[model samples]
Target chain A: MSLASLAPLVDAAAVGDPQEGVPLALYLAVSGGLFLLGLLGVLTRRNPLLLFLAVELLLNSANLALVGFSRYWNVTDGHVFALVVMVVAAAEVVIGLGLVVAVFRQRLALDVDQMSSMKG
Target chain B: MGERIVFTIAAASALSFGTLVVTLKEPFRATVALIGTLLSVAVLFLLLAAPFVAAIQVIVYAGAIVVLFLFVIAYLGERPIVEIGDRLGRYQAFAWLAVIGLAIQGFVVLATTQLPGVRDDPKQVGDIGSPEAIGRSFIDDYIVAFEATSLALLVAAVGAVMLAKRAVKSEGGR
Candidate 1:
């Protein structure tokens, strides 16, 4: 389906009255799909950059689920936790990128498969 | 309303760009996609009623972190050389399936279980959105964590400088 249609459905699930709108089941399904896509990227991709992107996707999926639950319950803690997760994600990207640069300088390649050769 | 529309757009952008970050063969394209994803995620944060976080997401993530990624991508050269296979091995596939299954199960449980409902008290609403309120709360409730985050940033700066200096030395020697 088109993403435009999916938006209303997701919004309805997130903010609609408990009885109507998109069902929680559907929201969870979408989250599951995203998580699976990320997992496939991580498992199949050999590039460290792509692997990190997959990791970010994994985190974003979790954030989506968190926001969905928060909206359903009408609380702010999930939102706060999502904020914390974002901060941690930013920090992770910095450190991960640094490591990537260092590794690339040493090995002149960005492949995760080649990183296995750690004979210094 | 506008909020919902903005949230939808942001979420879609984040997802599509995130996918591109992984699927693009060129590391430069991946870095660009990553930056787009981060910007969209910051917008998502704004939709969630956390403006402070949204600002931080833009400033720290899109601004600083992504620049770091781009620098690395540039330094490593922008050659599109990485080859990707279509499918993972059996064990990896199984592991991915298991993770997805577990996440779905957890979501189902949370959706079905009768946990304490979300508290929408006026008091809770009053303290969450404003920058001043967030700052006050951080200082009051999470002082140590906040301080630690600052320390971490300091360390990162130092480490980055060290690495740059080493690179300069090695290049000069060559």
Candidate 2:
């Protein structure tokens, strides 16, 4: 490709602001990083409470992307969806912590790997 | 230039605190890190001009959900954690690979030219997050989904009570 043809691509990158708002990629990159951190936590952490927290991180990252796209499109739809996700996340945490508390009371253990008796 | 500075600061704080939330040894300490992450994200929302979502994020996630998590932790009390073999060490390579892969994907998607630019002057876009706008959209287009969320919350409350009450009842009987 000619250097002249690539000039526009570089210029697009150089454009600090678009009329639409902030660049979509910036938000997506943060969201992806947050999601991966949460993934690592869920994979490596044994604590159920931390696991719930990691899941919360994942949900928050998704919310960030939603709001970003809402701004990108200049619409209210993404905002509403993000709101719904928040509600669902709240509910999920309540049930999750409740289960953890119940299980802890029963066995005084929160080691999820040890909860394998359901295989019976 | 100002926007660039704000974005940089917010993104840095959000990512660092998010990492801390995952990697911190103490769950309570991790929860504090989570608050930092949420607050930074709220700032990003403000930058995006969605003040309403920003406020909701602060009030709901930072204010309510996090407090709920702390209450549970306090009630449960801290216990000595068993050393699960060094899973992080074993998975460290894979984690790095996955993160790099996600970054590349995001870059390619973002680089695509298919995005439609803002429909109107970005600054001229008025109160998309205002209650009037949100309520109008919520009722006109998303009424069913909105109602579903309320129902889900109701179910969650009852289910939580049921689970906790059952545990208490069993203990009392014993």
Estimate TM-scores for all models.
0.71, 0.85
lDDT (0 to 1) per candidate:
0.63, 0.81
Index of the highest-TM-score prediction: 2
- Cα DockQ of the candidate 1 complex: 0.23
Q: What lDDT score goes with residue A54 in model 2?
A: 94
> Residue-wise lDDT of candidate 2 within B1-174, one digit each (tens)?
567567778999999999999989887899999999999999998888788889999999999999999998888876554455543367667767876787666556555535554222333456677767878989999999999999999999999999988999878863
> Which lDDT value does model 2 have at B61?
96
Clashing pairs in 1: none
Task: Determine which window of 10 residues in candidate 2 chain A has minimal summed lDDT.
Answer: A1-10
**Local accuracy of candidate 1 as per-residue lDDT tens digits, A12-100:** 53554343222334444545656766776777777787687778777776776675565455455555566666667776776677777
In model 1, the Cα lDDT at residue B103 comes to 68
- Any runs in candidate 1 off by more than 4 Å, and if so which? A1-37, A60-87, A117-120, B1-4, B78-92, B116-124, B165-174
The chain B TM-scores of all candidates, as shown, are 0.74, 0.83
Candidate 2 lDDT: 0.81
